[model samples]
Target: MIEIFGIPLSAFLSQLLLGLVNGSFYAMLSLGLAVIFGMLNIINFAHGALYMMGAFLAWMGLEYLGLNYWAMLLLAPLAVGVLGILIERLMLRWLYKLDHLYGLLLTFGITLVAEGVFRSFYGVSGQRYAVPDLLTGATDLGFMVLPNYRAWVVVASITVCLAVWALIEKTTLGATLRAGTENPRLVQAFGINVPRMVTLTYAGGVALAAFAGVLAAPILQVQPLMGSNLIIVVFAVVVIGGMGSILGSILTGLGLGVIEGLTKVFYPEASNTVVFLIMDIVLLIRPAGLFGKER
Candidate 1:
């Protein structure tokens, strides 16, 4: 068997694939954060809770409503998105003019509340979500066997990320959103409802988080604290990529995941801290982040 860097090639490939799967989650989660921060200037600390909500919603739907994975894939996000709309209309709208710290605090409180509410009902134990029938098997990829569900995750995440990127960076509506956030008065003068647009933008970002949650439910155990477990690392990814940079978040997230996976292979002890170590180095070197422009 061929080996790379003293590790068996098959093992390396398997780890690499695992890394990419992790990267897909990172990309999706960070993309949502980037959209919210970049466009709304709000530090959404409740994102993880919302993600947890998404997964739980999916699980609940499956359990009670007889909804399948495919159905929850669309419904869960929509449900979360509507909740996001309420959050924006009821609470977040009032804080837009204040400091980013306020938004962070408010969202943090929301996160606590959300997690508490779920924990009260569900406790800390994780719930299982079975993989869909169509994606239940594994594929032989010459050397390494790839799980269909994991491959779907990577493809789905990339597709969503790219679609969002294009929507924000290329389309006319994206231009309007950018313009609205940058100069709301100017957009408002053109007969656009800036407030509504902003609300929708926030909702969209929240929906993205929910979408990621649905994707993760089958792979990871669903639980109230699951979001909290991953949110800190995800925040590190966002910081390293740049607070509000779309492309930066996507690339940094994926890169960090792969780096973490590789670290697990070579130096298992440092696997957990590798991303943060890189984050520290990045902050020292380019405080603005890799794809972020210094503001």
Candidate 2:
């Protein structure tokens, strides 16, 4: 019976939860983007396609191999990560020394080709993925009923984000990665095999995307165009957080998700465009992005 601004508390909390779910996806995807761009300087327009591929891979494993959600959760990302490695070695590597536009174009083309291939067989209709048996029910929070799967998603996403942040910021390997990207030639001189490191970095980023896709599969339908539908907003999130900033991406993504959710509650008409509007405002004020270094 309680209300805030004439909106039921339950409705507001529900929207907030939905927003956090979305923000979890945004954080994961943009984290991948940040890693790839920061460590490899690749625009990776195909990231969304890879995400879709992950979801499809999970669905296929379930249908054909009788794999469960837990199994596919591991397998799908590994599969996509291997594919990402192939992509880097076979195609993306060649464009590294070239302009950033080249990498963007190549990845964009890959996105188109991937979408086309999937669409040819699957068509445009979405496929459903059921929630894992263990996470099938809802939990009664004192104020709101929370879906167990959604709670898992938020917890898992935040945990992953923190782990990745620590990996990049606190560890010796992370230091080497940052140095390798900044000066590959110098790192190569030290017998680090910088190229291999770069390849792995890209693979790791791709795996993160796949992981997100797997997480999203049960919530959203598995479809070819799913990636395209969300990629732009993820990109906006990355940009607003500051390109290549891990912490920025995580925080900004969660914050924006909550803001967007609240907008739906207060001003339904602007819900869809609210993120973009914020992006515009951020760009006007800080062109380097909220967390990016001015270079």
Candidate 3:
């Protein structure tokens, strides 16, 4: 066996691949949260629930409607995004005028309702999702056999993250979006519909989360409680990255996921609390987060 630092090279690289897979999902979900928080100033507690909804929606499409994976990829997120717009218009809009805590509470309630409803149907067990035939199997990398799907996951997520960052940071529409975030009244004075912009920003974020769910379906089980298990850790990622910086969110999420993976390999017990531990340390050293700007 090829060895590095007295450890089999294959073992180390495999763990790295697993870490990158996890990091992909973290980056996608955290980016969505950061976008919503930065623009709407709402800490969405329902994000996890939205992720669950994505899986359920895909299952619904497959079991009854006969939609394929590619189609569901587009349809699921669109459906979820539209629901987000409705939530914004009907419920979240009313709370935006009040304290941020109110928004959090309302979204938290939404999360519970969504999760509970899914649990009633799906039960506690996870349903199996088949990997597309194209993404199946593994490749020999001389030192290790790597799953094609995992590599696909990493590539897809990085592409999505970069595309979204470009849309938000480089485009004209992005300029408008950012301006609306900082000064809605001013943006509105110039005839841009600020409220509608806010609604769309939130919808975009929700869609991003749902899309991540679709990606996760093949590797992780498609279960009602899936998001509930991981959402808290994602929130920590958001805090550690600075809420407004899209790149910060992506880097912080991937970094933490790798750290967690390594902890599991070396010290199994600490894996559970590793992210939280880092969160506390970051809070102590820089309350603004690793890439956050001081307010």
lDDT of 3 by residue, 67-181 (tens): 8778888999999999999999999988776898999999999999988888898898998888888889999999899999899989998899999999998999999999998
Candidate 2 runs further than 4 Å off: none
Task: Mark the 10 consecutive residues where model 1 has the least summed lDDT.
Answer: 286-295
Write down the RMSD of candidate 3 (Cα, Å).
Answer: 1.1
Q: What digit string (tens of lDDT, one per residue) describes model 1 on residues 1-295?
A: 8999999998998898899888888898999999999889999999999999999999999999999999999999999999999999999999989999999999999999999999999999999999999999999988889899999999999999999999999999999999998999999999999999999999999999999999999999999998898899899999999998898889988999899999999999999999999999999999998888987
Q: Candidate 1 clashing pairs?
A: none
What's the residue-level lDDT of 219 in candidate 1?
97
Please give, for residues 187-288, the per-residue lDDT of candidate 2 as tens digits. 999889998999999999999999999999999999999999999999999999999999999998898888988999999999999999999999999998
Q: Candidate 3, after superposition: displacement of residue 284 in Å?
A: 0.4
Question: What is the TM-score of each predicted model, taking all chains together?
Answer: 0.99, 0.99, 0.97
Off by over 4 Å in 1: none
Residue 89, model 2: Cα distance from true site in angstroms: 0.5
Pairs that collide in candidate 2 are none
